[model samples]
Target: MKLSILDQSPIPYGKTAEESLSASIELAKMADTLGYKRYWIAEHHDMSGLACPAPDIMLSRIGAETENIRIGAGAVLLLHYRPYNIAERYNMLAVLYPDRVDLGIGRAPGGSAEATIALSGNFLENVSKMPETLDELLSFFEGNFPKDHMYSAINPSPVPKVSPEPWLLGTSEKSGILAAEKGIPYAFGHFMSEQDGPEIVKRYHANTKSGKSLVAVSVICAETTKEAEELALSSQLWKIQQAKGEGKKGVPTVEEARAYNFSDEKKNDKIIAGNSGVVKQELEVLQEKYQTDEFMIVTITHSFEARRKSYELIAKAFGL
Candidate 1:
């Protein structure tokens, strides 16, 4: 199996955003040396726990620090920005990193309603025009705009020798259909979605020209299954609280999570927490269901060291 990473740069309870970002850099460098295929930073806005709002900016810095791993925005929320500007920013990264850059595009707001309006005046309108925007963005990369088109003469520069590989990220079948129609690579957010992932992936492959599919999953691995579950408590509680419109101060400590009034009814089954062997077995089950060989793992824990260790254990488990 080919392993990759999706970093949200989660801030621990008492840690600052700066510390979270620094940890992301350290993680990326570690992933590069561990033989992971890619390192993707997610973009989120106005969220204290998830520190990164501009993945493009972070990717520029990460590319400089990591030697070989492909660095990218797991999904640059394309709804808030113009295609040309998005193309230009990623193109610059491509110039700097050569073939090790990816441009993963998604249509979600990636923020709250107020933040969405602040970024783009009409988020709904932008959603309606996604097809056109995606077409224009792909054209900028392929340089295939018609001669009479308004953007034909313009270039998203300084263009690199190799264009960034573009991937469409989604959690639903609509995204799969769009990716298939566009003929680009597809990345399914299995960690976040409640939909039928195998069905979506199957449809994407049935019609997709690229035939490339990647499943991004939330996972936590440790020396023992009990240890992994204990480490995952903070993240699990944070998510539960966040769903109830709280937890803005970042991931809480395990002690805090343990003290919380969370009940079994609020437990999150999405996070796959276990020992390395158990985690590998669960991932293999997912692989069989999704019929894909690549998985992008995302893990968030209160302790940075534990988070790092989780990735390390997973890497060793997969022999990456």
Candidate 2:
């Protein structure tokens, strides 16, 4: 099983965007050295704390800084951009990195109205037709939309097509069907949706048509479960605000995470936050129950020391 890394450039309370990006770069380098399979950064626009509004650009910077590490946007919010443009942009990245690049796609706007409007401009009209819009985008990437079959107006590129693997990500069952029907790989966001990991993975794997199917989950690792949970909350708070569309409550003071509320314990355990021994049992169970071939982890601890521990423990646990 292959494991990957996903970071959305979470803005720690009181830190600047530059700080978040710099930290992501550092983490990317660490993951590469530690034998993590891939390092994918997410794209979020106009969030007070998120620094990855343009993941393509950031992935380029990250790819330049690391070697032999698969670097790509954890996802491009395909809803917000034209398919041809996305195809070309990611295609260029693929050219630079060859098979080392991947293109993760999600249906979410990756932001709210004001931010979407600001970032997408006239393209905002394209939002209402999400499934169709995604179809158009994929048409460009696949170079086979067959405009004659439809009355819509879309021009796809025949040259420099994006050959990178496309990973469809979502929090709902509908996304599973969409990914399966389209013959694309799918990833369940267990971190955001608070769903059962084994069930989601099983559903996707059972229904997947032809592409490689994978599951990505979130976790915080430490010598003990308590420390993992504590660090995870701190890491997730920075993410929740960015994702839940709330304005920042200002930079987080060091102690604020202690006071914040995330989901209950039943919810947190899916991330499998614990020591090496405990997490291994969890992963083996997940693999068997989910019948999965590939698994990715979004480790939530952001401290340099904690992040390293998270990767090391998982690798050791998996005997990788």
Candidate 3:
């Protein structure tokens, strides 16, 4: 029922890291004032042009500036950090911000072959463990959850838990299964998730341990079908460029994003765009397809004003 933003510390193709951070700070403040549920940052490391490699560092800065918004990594590169350390860092932040911090987790580092190796280091064997490694992570965050509890029909609250909201973030069915089996929330990376965004959500809910947790994450939402298509194009361009292994710092403005070309088939269902009525209809369809009434949308516009306006319009339409 709420919306959110996934800012990539977007350094336009030519901007400096400092400039990108500054722009993100401004954008965070704007989102905070607008009453968005959360503003999550993506983590991509070691790429010569990407700057948001460390979301924890950036999150502290975002948290320091915002009052009510839940600031977090749309995903932390869980495969890169130690389970114990991840727990401790997020626990400290949760204590500092209380209920406002979310620990969205993803196996991917949002980078390349070289970047992944660099991050894993000797931890390479660790990443290979996969879902087993994933269990350790969830247990660590739950603050001392024993290894055995993860396998049996067990609940995971036993110690001074690092209870920041937990979310399994990815585009695949595996991520969805992880969320449901563990009783955690699931966030599909719609920006990069290759179709079946709703189906992923459905799979998670169907297997949910107790069906008590709220299931949702961030997806770009825009106003007017045309505006939506335009913003989606911008997002798609970044995806395309990033996939081609072109790394850049900072986020791109709407204008900078519109410079690329795309096909309707590629974007038609990937993003949600429309006026209030259109938004309502579109979201309703998405909600039903996902089998959940809750969702977090990213009101994407290339310009700040347009983004803000899109937020306002969606908020009013959603009655949030």
Highest lDDT against the true fold, candidate: 1
Which stretches in model 1 have alpha-carbon errors above 4 Å? none
Candidate 2 stretches greater than 4 Å from native: 121-128, 145-162, 195-200, 236-254, 259-270
TM-score computed on alpha carbons, candidate 1: 0.98
lDDT of 3 by residue, 112-138 (tens): 677677778655576577677777777
TM-score of 2: 0.84
Write down the worst ten-residue block by lDDT for model 2: 151-160
Residue ranges of candidate 3 with Cα displaced over 4 Å: 47-50, 122-124, 145-162, 211-228, 245-269, 299-302
Ranking by lDDT: 1, 2, 3
Q: Give model 2 RMSD, 1 decimal.
A: 3.7
Evaluate candidate 3 by giving its C-alpha RMSD to the native, one decimal: 4.7
For candidate 2, write residues 1-320 as lDDT tens digits: 67778887766656677877888898888878778788889887766666788989988888888888888777898877767788778878877777788888886777767777776665556656767877766776666756575623544333343377788888777788778877788877766675665676667767865756667777667788777777776655655554555537433432676786555423344567777777777777777866876677876554656766888778767666
Q: Best to worst by TM-score, what's the order?
A: 1, 2, 3
Residue 89 shift from truth in candidate 3, angstroms: 0.8
C-alpha lDDT values of all predictions = 0.94, 0.72, 0.67
Steric clash pairs (candidate 3): 1-295, 3-297, 10-250, 10-251, 11-249, 11-250, 11-251, 221-298, 224-274, 254-302
Clashes of each: 0, 4, 10
